[model samples]
Target: MLPPDARMLASQNIVIILCGNKKDLDADREVTFLEASRFAQENELMFLETSALTGENVEEAFVQCARKILNKIESGELDPERMGSGIQYGDAALRQLRSPRRAQPQGTQECGC
Candidate 1:
């Protein structure tokens, strides 16, 4: 359960709740789609299931969350510059640092040496 203040922020902002690792175990341990959806509805969260092993819906989950955040920004429900806001690009510089970098081959010259 979330704290009262955190829950209030979550309610005010768009929240996406995802359950991962569905491909590893039997169906018993897996949370069902209906159950997840119900939980999301009850708590006002967006729910999705994904398999990290299979890379299923991984990108979709992020995209959906981004869209929801964008909607909140557009609707004036959230301030992009606000601290603790869930906007993805709130710290754009951190995103640049988090991006994957291409490793250059050792002793390989860029001039076709």
Candidate 2:
């Protein structure tokens, strides 16, 4: 059974969970960090937070989540054959070969004796 708030937003295999942390603002006016974390855990969603003031765990949170996703991909938990998960080759040399080539220097012959 899917979580109450879990809705299929896209046909592609993608799930996004939004959580708000940092309750130090007014305490009574904000959702507690633990509450947000628990909600994510209960729904099997990635949980992360950052303090814009102190920048605590901002980079770490992103890196950690990325590592987790990569690990899943490597372990075959996430299928690489999917549209966005497929391997991408960005070598410039391959791209150049596809385009029209310019005239080569006369001295530089293709045959290597």
Candidate 3:
């Protein structure tokens, strides 16, 4: 179960994803997929496994999360204009998305683990 603070944040419609990282090191895994999946289901979180070494599902994880947030926003479940909602819009956000830099090596990429 999530702690009080986390539950409060979740109550605010914060998008949560349970990401199992370091999938490239599966041989050394301490938890089984069923165990993690069960936990995610109980917690109502989207679940995914990713590998920083191979960049597997890294981008997809973020994209899915973003889509959920956008859906909430569009359905009026979340109000970007509300104080402390932790959502913002405008040209700055678009500009940030458009800014680009040199790409990192795929094997060296690390996403929200």
Candidate 4:
């Protein structure tokens, strides 16, 4: 995950979503639905509760995100023809791949915690 100061992709009319997973497990719940919804509303994010096992709101979350992106594209908010438009690998991913850091094998650790 990127650091706090390294986060700026949400700006410039970008559609953002705040999703909470594992809604199917109500017993182990932490954050309530209303709290999440209120945060989403306050921050202008599409909130969804999804479970990978049951596939609850998984499709809906993706559809809502796609719909927002499409709406922006249709309204000339996002120009795909631009050089830096559309999905591309972020600098962090690129640096990871190009760096000299080799993938560590499972169960092997440099620090024993």
Model 1 residue 23 lDDT score: 41
lDDT by residue (tens digit), candidate 1, 4-69: 575566546656555545644546565666877787677777777777778887777888886676
Number of backbone collisions per candidate: 0, 0, 0, 0
Worst 10 residues of 4 by lDDT: 1-10
Candidate RMSDs in Å, in order, are 10.3, 12.7, 9.4, 14.0
Candidate 1, residue 107: Cα displacement in angstroms equals 48
lDDT of each: 0.62, 0.53, 0.79, 0.68
RMSD value for candidate 2? 12.7
Worst 10 residues of 3 by lDDT: 93-102
The CA lDDT at 89 in model 1 is 61
Enumerate residue pairs that collide in model 3.
none
Best by TM-score: 3
Per lDDT, the best of the predicted structures is: 3
| Backbone clashes counted, model 4 | 0
Write candidate 3's Cα lDDT for 40-83 as tens digits: 99888899999988999999999999888776876777766677
Candidate 4 lDDT, 1-113, residue by residue in tens: 22333226434566778879998898999999998899878766778989988999888888889778655765667765566565433566443322334567998874311
If the candidates were sorted by their TM-score against the true structure, best first, what order would they fall in? 3, 4, 1, 2
User: Can you write out model 2's per-residue Cα lDDT over 1-113, one digit (the tens) per residue?
Assistant: 33544344332323344434352354554666777778777766777675556666666666766566455555555554466543333575534333334567988765211
How high a TM-score does candidate 3 get?
0.74
TM-score of each: 0.60, 0.53, 0.74, 0.65
Q: How far out, in Å, is residue 36 in model 4?
A: 0.6
- As for candidate 4, its clashing pairs are none
